[model samples]
Target: MFRFLRGLVLPEAACDEANNSSRYENLFKKLDVNEDGRVDIAELHAGLKALGIPLGKDAEETIFKTGDSNKDGQLDFEEFMQYLKDHEKKMKLAFKSLDKNNDGKIEASEIVQSLKILGINISEQQAEKILKSIDADGTMSVDWNEWRDHFLFNPATDIEEIIRYWKHSTVLDIGDSLTIPDEFTEEEKKSGQWWRQLLSGGVAGAVSRTGTAPLDRLKVMMQVHSSKSNKMNISSGLKQMVKEGGVRSLWRGNGVNVIKIAPETAIKFWAYEQYKKIFANEDGKIGTVERFVSGSLAGATAQTSIYPMEVLKTRLAVGKTGQYSGMFDCAKKIFKREGLKAFYKGYVPNILGIIPYAGIDLAVYEALKTAWLDHYASDSANPGVFVLLGCGTVSSTCGQLASYPLALIRTRMQAQALLEGAPQLNMVGLFQRIIANEGILGLYRGIGPNFMKVLPAVSISYVVYEKMKQNLGLA
Candidate 1:
């Protein structure tokens, strides 16, 4: 049996799955670090340590005791997997056995009976609240499937880790738990620091310019040709752009975009700073909730104030086919044709989206920076440049990926404003049209180029901005 299993299990590369399964499997292996076919208290402690889990021994023991089934003093791989797979469900199951009624669900009455049998303590109100949350269908009863599915496919693992880190980290009392080496010179820090800040800022600027440019182009094309009412394929649209104005046609609105980047960056960075300061302390330490609030508000403030300029930029980019004379003409035309409201066509989704985008982006970037700092421990090689690059890649990727759907909505809404006699499409209609015409992937049109362009570009921008501030004694 051992030989057969060994033969079946090739090396790590061979065991890799084709999709997201590989990620889960890798996480599982990290959790099962000992390769001992089971996880005991010692093994669990070691695994937690490897994951940077900083909980106390008592807390660790509580988690382990609840996780280990059969009271066998150790948990086998299967038991460990089961415990991880549906933690809440498994706990409830242990309670459910006490119910003595095969109702295929758990409720307040059920909880009382179940807790009684398990000799556990819980009040009626608590039981009711728990039951309601787990009910899934608002039926006041949580069936096995609902309970299992909720816990089994839980993607809140990161959130849970964040919670754990927050709790333990609070006790550490901030003061550089990680150390910087004496040999690391001030010159090196200076070189890396200012360069990284500028690079990171530039990246944010470039991505903001580039991402909105193509979509602006598309929206304009849609608007201009709305009178004709012909569907535009991604390819044909490109062809039309090139044919109408030569090779430079695709870059028609780039001038306006170039100018817009500075203000957009200023607003975004400024708002982010203000909001972060307001929500957090001087050291810029914040919990998940605070991070979310700060980020969201930052995005909202920046996007809302700069939206008119954004609209102007889009018009210029998309007016390649003689739709509008130039940025000035486009603005004048819009103001004349549709009034000032034209500039703020899709402000609702645009403003609201900033919140989550800022929150997730900042939260992820800051968290990644902290983690990298922990791992590298103030090594000279892990300069501000490296930090900016790493954080930029993560933050930009997360922000763009999460914001794609809303972006599509904003695009359609803005396009609708420019297109004469074009059928008015709500968010649902827009999604349906995209699905029918180009499939689900249509909504994520520029995600690939967005990711590729963002990482290095933003890194450099950030490096430059930070270093500039430091040199100017403004930081």
Candidate 2:
């Protein structure tokens, strides 16, 4: 049943191993649920879930088969002890491997080195936070005993497994349209499954973006064109777009939008890793502010690298039909007509927007989660999946709301040349012109379609991601 799961294991740390049998007994009692002196599959699943180790069906079956010596579909005390002892032996081996130079301890440097081998990069300071979690003595290093005790109940078979969980995104979207990349275990990397995961995510993103392209194009149009003379509401905006171009023109800029996701995500993730090192605190820990600063800087770095594409995207979205052949042609014309500097129009406001977007996103997300916890603590300890997603969606929308004017201005600045007789304005002047001409409401033109696309984008991305995972044997 678990032909492909037999080799997958968790990382092991060493502990006293003294009174190990008794420890096993206590754990067994806990998993036994009904005090029947045995743990069946159902109880075992529940117990593992409580430990926050989500195992797949194949992994669960492999584990169950390994410990059920009598073939009874359950673990008696003796079998359970034997299984744990066997696991500990492997855990000790894992610890020995991590203790480079035969030092009998794992230091932050060692942790960093080990992860780099698995394609996960982190600075020594970032590694220290990981070390602090298991370094009970405040000695800044983990001995075998501390390692074993720290992960006694964890199902992770290797350091990579634990590290993946630690580094995984908490849905703390610090920038508009930016998501932290997914982390993968060593096994996944070695087996070439990491790329598959990335491919799936990219596919999901493409599908989501394409599905919402019409609204996106409309949003860009309204952001650039709406003023005192021309108030382009959603209804009129759609008709105007259709009048100018065919139905398919609604997706004018989508090709480049989908094409840019890969490089943008790659650059953003790489920049984030580097930024975390720079922002690392002396005390070897990262808090909300640190995270925000690191993420904001990373988002800036990524945007700077990809800003040209951003300009191209804006241009293509607002361009008349047959204005340019395609993304390449659009870029060529822009480069030829305007100097390289035009590609970076509105760079200041774009970077400025990141701070508020990230800060408010993080703050509102935390507040929402806290409120959810406060209200539902007695009923449910964990805010279920839907609640978490809801909180994330609302928090992200709030962040966009706070930063939308900046985005609107940035879009206008990019598409200024496309609009004939449109005043060439810097970020500040753009703001003044919009406010003087169309009032405060004009600053948020096209927000209706922007909000309208959010649900469909989220839903499509999620559904496609899950489907892709299953297709790639990751589910």
- Scored by lDDT, the top model is 2
- The deviation in Å at residue 163 for candidate 1 is 22
Shift in Å, residue 115, candidate 2? 21
Per-residue CA lDDT of model 2 for 123-143, tens digit only, reads 565566667656656698888
Off by over 4 Å in 1: 1-239, 265-288, 370-384, 436-438, 459-475
**Residue range with the least summed lDDT across 10 consecutive positions in model 1:** 170-179
Q: What's each prediction's TM-score?
A: 0.47, 0.70
Model 1 TM-score? 0.47
lDDT of 1 by residue, 26-63 (tens): 44566566676666777666765555443444445555
RMSD of each: 19.3, 9.6
The Cα RMSD in angstroms, rounded to one decimal, for candidate 2 relative to the true structure is: 9.6
**Model 2: ten consecutive residues of lowest lDDT:** 1-10
